[model samples]
Target: MELRIGCRRPPEESVPGLLRYRIASKIVKRQPLGGTDDEWVVIEPVYRAIELLEQLHDTPAQEALLIGRFSFNVRFKWFKNWANSEASRRLGLASIPDGPANLRMLRRTLSLEMAYRPGGVLATKIYMKHIAVATTEGCASRPGGAQAELLAEVNQHESERDLHLVLEEFRNYQEGVLPAGPGARSLTEFFAGIDAQLDAASAAAPKTQRNDRDVLNLLTKRAKVLHLGPANYCWFTGPSRALCLKLAGTPTVDRPLIGMCGSARCPQATHHSGHRSVWAEHADRTKIFLGQLGTTRKTERTRLQADHDRALRVIAGIDSAIAIEG
Candidate 1:
């Protein structure tokens, strides 16, 4: 990293080279403060990654990729933080980074962070399903994925030129930016707003297209909520950043800005487990694995069925209890 930075820096200042030298010196001295702890270190990498992800999520396919990538990145970051910290590390918080515990946490955290993440995924599935259903319904009604088709066109144009420009033009024509043309406005003209008219047209877009904007809106909104930057999780209230930001007269990290998506029973739950330890249990795959096996094999079938039935009873009991409570 230092060498790369050094190569980019001016020959005179050798900014990155100097920074690397200082880091090397600090490492030799066994000082943690010398590396990432530098007071002047900027969060450029983190912000850039987030910006790129945001830019991609404006399209349907890229939005899916961004959500998946964001989920993975956030989970990886959480695991790293947990491993680095004393309290969580002792609890095996970061053990098996992509295991059930971490995946569940990521899924839960995502749902909480954006009420839309889960909803958006489900909506996307439903939309696709609806398209499939509509296709079979009748030829006339089968404008299957018309919205996605439109977005794909926009997305293609975005890749070819400026995305912001494409979006602005789309928004303007959709919002009636100009006097109605003699013929219905051409798709080409609908997307080509002059720089001078751009600001006013852009200002009117959000309100005008609020109801019509695609799933990308949900993704962008979620990204904003989570602060999933390019390289790191900047919105997180880590120890050093928290302290530094406070000193700089920034808002104090006082409350839980994000929600706890997991239940109290989750392995990574902040609360104490009712049992001896949350780690004692794992996701019960007895039934699933058993069903996949050759169930016709007598001995294996007997043993598997026994385990599966027990798991079934346990899950049923939990469900019943939850239903009664509700």
Candidate 2:
């Protein structure tokens, strides 16, 4: 029976060009079987064939050829033998024996496409029966099954650990230890302010509980406060630029800052004392830049002056917030 193997192309080429070049160079240096220049010239095609083989080596073409050959051999040899033995066993033939020590080897050889083929149903049914028999006979006591179970258990443990971490963060927020923004004196005040806003919103809305729940969920779940940017703004928030659901495509966790923050009003932002140096440095740099400019660069100087003023304003805001008592 003809079997097609589906092999996904690797992201990168398996074989380096340097290896092929080395092989080709070695072949070129080898003397012809005839040991004479005249005869060697006649056998030049053999040398060209070797070069062609070297070129094809370790490439996707070679991989496909190898996979096809492997699948064909396994289907006709191992799978055919196993099926015959299984049929005999079902017929109560005592002389027929078990196919092999490990049926997984045969299963691994069958490609994903082969499983969906016209005659694949019989093969799949035989494989499933074999597995069922193995499990009933306690053959699943193998190391591979144990390892799989262990891996699943570890994943569950990690998930539970992450949940606890989130809960701890929430606890810190409740205790007023977590920084929220420049407008709030403490985390407690920040949450109280949010509660007050939610209350006001609930009063106007027909579904007050639902609106309050949604807003609270956004704060506790989706929002991720981070210290980021030139000011080390403690309140920089969102799922982070990388984790933001609004962003298109696969999100990457490596991005260091929130790209487009919503400032103090953002659910994700929180200012803390740790961010003071960032703002201080920004203000200092902007002041120095403003002093260095002349009247000739009026537009540039104006921009720099505005930045300097903004930096100073942020610094003042942070200080005022910190000075407030409970």
For model 1, how does the per-residue alpha-carbon lDDT over 1-326 read when each residue is reduced to its tens digit?
Answer: 21111111112334744432121111112435534322112234533444465555556442133333146567677766777788876776664444444654654454333323423433333422323423322322323344455568876664434333334434444454331111112222323433324456558784553332342332232223222111112223232333334444544554222233212221111111121122123224665666677746888878877756644443443333323310
Q: Rate the local accuracy (lDDT) of all candidates.
A: 0.36, 0.47
Per-candidate TM equals 0.16, 0.32
Judge candidate 1 against the unseen true structure and give its global Cα lDDT, from 0 to 1. Answer: 0.36
lDDT of 2 by residue, 1-326 (tens): 11111222112333763211111111212447523221111124444554454455565443233222245555556654765686767977565255543445544444233335554433333533443423412332232333345468876775455444434444445454454354244445546666576667778985746443355453553234434443333332324433232343434444333554434444444455556777789789999998899879999998898878876766776676556544
Model 1 TM-score (2 dp): 0.16
Instruction: Please tell me which predicted candidate would have the highest TM-score against the true structure.
Output: 2
Error of 2 at 84 (Å): 47
Per-residue lDDT value at 142 in model 1: 23
Q: Model 1: clashing residue pairs?
A: 49-230, 50-229, 50-230
* Stretches of model 2 off by over 4 angstroms after superposition: 1-190, 193-257, 260-268
